[model samples]
Target chain A: DVKVTQSSRYLVKRTGEKVFLECVQDMDHENMFWYRQDPGLGLRLIYFSYDVKMKEKGDIPEGYSVSREKKERFSLILESASTNQTSMYLCASRRQGPEQYFGPGTRLTVT
Target chain B: DQQVKQNSPSLSVQEGRISILNCDYTNSMFDYFLWYKKYPAEGPTFLISISSIKDKNEDGRFTVFLNKSAKHLSLHIVPSQPGDSAVYFCAANIIQTGANNLFFGTGTRLTVIP
Candidate 1:
């Protein structure tokens, strides 16, 4: 079975504070992705990494950045968190297939 | 632009009946479709999938039916149990876009009453 784990299941941060969400996968998948899910808006892609040093911006990458220094780890960074950035963050990893295994997700609340 | 759409926000079904969840897509480039079930406070889990070449795919109690002409697909769970209740999301895999990102719908929350 494939397992993906996140650093935190719930987080609280103040406005303008820097926040980091970490994701780790044990399947050695090449594709990793970060998505923010909101009610009525669905899950929107924030960023995706195809390799350890390769990354691409997704549809909603405005207030976020990503780091993929290693294959098993993918981290999402919020340079300066805002109240609007509060959302459920999900990390997924896949290997040359359509099926993506996702982590438990981190619910970030920016106050 | 919401390429994948699940118009229904929720569905209710009896424990022994069949639960049908629908999904529609506007992009013709989508060649692969998948269904994912998500529980509260957890990430979406893969349920079943069907490629454009096939019209139907079945996995135990879950069956996926696809209509290429209408660009639509539906997932049916037979003998629905309480454990089957969850938010089901439909996702599409776009081809030739140089990216393998799967576009997802808003999701439909299914409630299976005992």
Candidate 2:
């Protein structure tokens, strides 16, 4: 079974604060993704990394950045968090196959 | 623009009844479609999938029917149980694109009352 773990299950941050969400996968999948889910918006891709240090912007990449310095870890960074950035964050990892294993998700509340 | 759409935001059914969830896609390049189930506070989980070449796929109580001509698909859960209640999201990907990204729908929340 593949395991994807996130650094935090819930986080509360103040406005204009820097925030980081970390994800790690044990499967060594080359493909990793970050997504935010909001009511009536579904899962919108924020960023994705296909390989180490390789990143691509998804549909909604604004106000967010990603880092993939190692194979197993992927981090999502919010340079300066805002109230609008509060939402559930999900991390997923996939190999060459179509199936993507996902972490439990982190619910971030920016006050 | 949302390439995949689930117009229904929510559905309710009695326990032991059949639950049908529908999804529509506007992109012709998508060759594979998948359904994911998500619970509150948890990430979405892979539920079922179907290839464009095949019109139907079934596993246990879950069956997925695809209509290529209409660019639509449906998921049917038989004898729906309370545990099956969750948010169902339909996702699609283009195999030819070789990109691992998948287009997702807004999702429909299913509720099964015992």
Give RMSD to native, each candidate.
0.9, 0.5
- Model 2 regions lying over 4 Å from their true place: none
TM-score of each: 0.98, 0.99
- For residues A1-111, write the lDDT of model 2, one tens digit per residue: 999999999999999999999999999899999999999999999999999999999999999999999999999999999999999999999999777888999999999
Q: Could you give candidate 1's per-residue lDDT for residues B1-114 as a string of tens digits?
A: 999999999999999999999999999889999999999999999999998999999999999999999999999999899999999999999655656689999999999999
lDDT of 1 by residue, A1-111 (tens): 999999999999999999999999999999999999999888999999999989999999998999999999999999999999999999999998888999999999999
TM-score of chain B of each: 0.96, 0.98
Scored against the native two-chain complex, candidate 1 gets a DockQ of: 0.79
- How far does residue B29 in candidate 1 sit from its true spot (Å)? 0.7
In terms of DockQ, which candidate is strongest?
Answer: 2
DockQ of each: 0.79, 0.83
Which one wins on lDDT? 2
